[model samples]
Target: MSSVASQVILHPNVSKSLKVLGTNLGRDKLYRAVQYFARFLAWYLVSRGYKVQGARWNALKSHLALARKLMRLGKPIEHLQAALRAAQIAAEPGEQITTICRQLGYFGYLTYDTLVWANAIKFFNFKPSTAEKVSKNANRLWLAGILFSITHGLLKAGRLANDVRKLQNAHLTEKGQDVDRDAKLGNLYNARDATRHQFIIDLLDVWIPASNLGFTNLNDGVLGIFGLITSLMAFRQQWLAVNGK
Candidate 1:
């Protein structure tokens, strides 16, 4: 089909019309359409960062790790640009991921000053308002990023698992001995992916809420632990991806 035809078919009104015509349109299709329409709103709030009270980091969390590594290694500005491109390509095409890449790209541009100042403040441990200001900002940003990863990643994995379950159920037949093997294989893959996502989600959900409730502030110590473990996992993933393992 032509691009225009595909767009017309995917349009919300068209989808609704199909549903009205007794088409067995899945709820997932409707949900995806709604998400597409809400992309701009989500992107706007996400770009507002901490300003809007509850905006989380989204995929910018991944970029932040690369940012941290780049800044620490004194990598050139070009390296950051390359990393931003990489991140953009890795993420699915959508306003939310676009905002995340842009936000992290802007931060990457500040490497010369922001990274230097941040490092100096950390090393010196200035106990006055300057230190407090730095600490507070860092803590809040880290908390936002960590929570964002946990929540969104879990939701995505859960949705995948649910879809697989639906497919598996739809394949159930009267002939019990001749089961649909493809559905079984798909469920196996879903189970593996779900387990991985749940593991990370569980790991963060435990300490993150606990740290927040106990102190009402997720500072360096709390977020640091979350970031550290997640980063290690990310590194492992990168290694596997690069090696085609």
Candidate 2:
């Protein structure tokens, strides 16, 4: 019994889960998943005439949003630094431009979002209209960031496709050459897969800010599901990175 208990305690999966939960990103993703789930549940319950129960879930969602805001207090600077780094790195001009714009958009969003969080916590006593304006601007910036990300992903996919075609042609024509075609193709495929994964996540997430900005009329139920899906996708990626998988 003691040996069995020890085995369970020392399990690799358990260790990896703990490692994932240790990071701020991991914790945020977990909380975001729950928050979005609560948002969907609240909407469903209210639609079914369970106002009181729905209110409880709505409160849960609000609290989780507040917690996430607090966790991201210093994230604006991180985005700024990322933008700077992206500018220095060499890449196709389109990719480099989109990457920098995306980072800057996020930086703007987070800066405004910080103000929104402060207002929510009563740390800043801005007028209600001012608060609304700030929040709207934040959502706008977030949407821009996601749009830039999507553009970057599309450009990356196109480049990858071109590379694959070129590699295939080279392999066919240069059969006597010592080029490692298979290894190169494998690397390109992996990169393409990662790009596609992020593209999907971005596509799902864009609707959230769009809805907030009134560009879309998605209700809480649909928005909640979208948010939950993107959060889980990000969480899985973070989990794999943490576990060295």
Candidate 3:
């Protein structure tokens, strides 16, 4: 298969984004470019007094900070811990309890899944049944991670929708009918709509096993490498069985 096809087969979301950008840049370079652009955009908006309403703004800031800290490659466990801290700080809003819980839950499941895969890969003399069991557990962990993400997206969107409703009701009560819309609240509603739409896309993406375990937005080079190794191991086992080795 072509390189592009291999990438699409292995990492559809990342490849799609790169295709959208119409760049021939390597995955790592493109990913870094996107992250830097996002960080710059967030800073520019905040500097211009544009902010997401309520604790959402803080959440955005925290994410930006987290991104800056992880701009360079580091230990996976350290990155996961930083992600957990960012999520906790972001969840300080009164209504984001569910969102935060889902974030933490995904990380937990992902860590478990990664560990299981590591064990299976490292254990050279794994019995066939043990390997099968590990594979089964990894699949379950992947599903759990996806479920947590879907739940988080749902709760976050719901909270924003509720805010929009309250804003609409208050406006109606004061003016006897809707007139000029509150821009801030309207933005929140729009954001909620976007989140719902993205969640649907995410659900589809997670059905693919190599989709970063649904814990991040960028290309996961590590997961891709691990997945490739796992595939080769499985293939090797199958070949051995066929050859009666």
CA-lDDT, candidates in order: 0.47, 0.95, 0.51
Q: Estimate the Cα RMSD of every predicted model relative to the unseen true structure.
A: 20.6, 1.8, 20.7
Candidate 2's residue-wise lDDT over 4-69, tens digit each?
Answer: 999999998889989999999999999999999999999999999999999999999999999999
Q: Model 3, 1-245: lDDT tens per residue?
A: 69978877779555444453452223333343344344445544555677654235445434543443333323345535755675657563533544444445455545544545445446345677876665555555556555666776877777777777777777355663454556767689768866775576456536445443344444333333333343344333343333335
Q: How far in Å is the alpha carbon of 21 misplaced in model 3?
A: 8.7
* Candidate 1 least-lDDT 10 residues: 23-32
Q: In angstroms, how far off is 44's CA in candidate 1?
A: 45
Model 1, 119: alpha-carbon shift in Å? 5.5
Off by over 4 Å in 2: 1-7, 172-179
My TM-score estimates for the predictions, one after another, are 0.40, 0.94, 0.42
The alpha-carbon deviation from the true structure for residue 79 of candidate 1, after best TM-score superposition, in angstroms, is: 14
Task: Name the candidate that leads on lDDT.
Answer: 2
lDDT of 1 by residue, 59-159 (tens): 34333433443334443354456546656565444423533543443344344335435555464455577655554454444444444445545555665
Point out the higher-scoring one by TM-score: 2 or 3. Answer: 2
For candidate 2, the per-residue lDDT at 225 reads: 98
Q: How close is candidate 2 to the true structure, as a TM-score?
A: 0.94
